[model samples]
Target: MGMIDQLLVIWGEPAAGNRQVIGHLARSAGEFRFWYEDDLAKAQARGFQMLPEFPVHRRADDPYIGRYLFALFAERIPAPTRRDSAEMMTAWGVDHPDDQFKVLARSGGIRATDRLELAEYRAVDDDLSRPLEFRIAGRRHITDAAPLAVEDAVSLRREPDNTADPAAVIVDRMGRKAGYVPRQYTQLLGGLVERGVPLQGKVVRELLLPDDVGKLVVRIVSSRL
Candidate 1:
């Protein structure tokens, strides 16, 4: 299993610049789950563990917009050859081949055109007062996916649910009205599913957020390492 180190969410509109931050993740047995609801009893009952919630900054005077969430998985990569370093101080063979081994690591942010292996959907519940459950499934092997504009992702409002007679899913990307899907990413997700890739969660647009925040929803189905 791969390790999920950090999850970052960037929110806000392009005109407003983006309000962004890196999120701290709570540890699960081998995977991590993030939800927008206030509670997590059912997920716990399903054998999924909760990592800690990322703290939110609340302002008394301002109304709250939604947040963008990013998940980072840290898979161990083999150390590069010591000679690969542009700077070399000590030579190999003396105490430990170059007294110290130092290398810079970079975070993998989604590019405009990167392939994401994922399944996305809006969270649904039996009652209005009940919590919404968003289901995400990651792909085993995904590539050439790109982040879609706010208007491009698709909306999944209602679907048959075995748990409830009239359960429904509603997602509002940009928080316009109740919820609607952006068209572009939705098509991409559908293609992956048709190809038989394993998915993690449904990738939906974050609504009520500023339209300027450029971010992509990606799923990790196969091991990249």
Candidate 2:
């Protein structure tokens, strides 16, 4: 199976509910590499701490290289031995559950145990003509908005004045504020919007259970066709 080359490591403060890119992980020719970003210091000041496997004292310029995936991320992948492992992998669009890089990219390496997550870093020129899925962020804060249902059409609006992130792209449902696009796709989607590229969004999934309320996944496609 094919694999992604790079992923952005994002750290979020659970209390404040803010996220920032703190590092990058990459794979090239069988070797894996990881390095902290300059933003690491800012994240540290915001109550983020060095991961046990990645020391804060390490110089950002010197990347850690290894033949195997870092434990920090490897642990996020569901164990192949789990009874529902195949279902989980299929949900993430991964055919091979053992393809760690692809799984991480599709799943965002999200785990309840940590605030760290991974996002595939797509190039500015990457094609968006194909449909892609992105979980709407900040839904929990949109209490006044009406519930969204599958197949519901959504609109994207740029929020250049947003205090937290100038590149923010908000999703709207039935003319009400639903949520914002995940930060990982903001740069890409925001750039496209700036270029006057028409984009379309439709609700692909919605979790309505008490615990997973407001969790939504939207399918986005460039309307350049």
Candidate 3:
């Protein structure tokens, strides 16, 4: 399996609403950069603050508070990092206060009924300027054929009639079908294909157990021109 870089987007409060593209998380020459959509001075003037230890209002006077939250920890979140259960729990916080958190905010404008603040970013050279990579979130992987060797690169095909995911993914081998793409990525990658976008995937990992369903890890990288 190939060792690839993966991205995990942690969303802040008010999950839904108009999320302004304040900026993006990207990279250049392997250096991390948190580019700002708006000027730093302007953002500071907007009353951006991240006191997550205290109860920050989900409905605060300042609309950009959510973005400020991401700004609080922009330097810590890098691509291709693995987090354990303890870390995730710390980041998500339980019933009480939790300090470990990193999420980009989305603010709904004045007229919007619901709004949330947001912030976040990354770095890279001009050739790879856009943040085009995303990891699909799914619970299980399905297969009816024998396990493929670990790290076998495969093609991803569309499955229009898949009951579980209409935009299902069918993993392929040398031009024939091998297995289905992980459940979570179905609709997302499928939609990209429908729009005439091509895709490329690599087997990042695989683990076959004699006592249970095996696990295969496939990573889809953006091939958009």
Give lDDT for model 2. Answer: 0.78
Candidate that would win on TM-score: 2
In model 3, where do residues sit more than 4 Å from their true spots? 1-143, 207-214
User: What does the lDDT read for residue 31 in candidate 2?
Assistant: 90
Each model's backbone clash number = 45, 0, 21
Model 1 alpha-carbon miss at residue 78, Å: 11
Q: Which ten residues in a row have the lowest lDDT in candidate 2?
A: 206-215
RMSD of 1: 19.4
Write down the RMSD of all candidates, one decimal each: 19.4, 3.0, 13.1
Task: Go through the candidates in order and give each one's C-alpha lDDT.
Answer: 0.27, 0.78, 0.39
Off by over 4 Å in 2: 1-3, 56-61, 130-132, 161-166, 206-214
Report the error of model 2 at residue 30, Å: 0.7
The number of the candidate with the highest lDDT is 2
Models 1 onward score TM values of 0.19, 0.85, 0.37
Model 1 accuracy (lDDT, Cα): 0.27
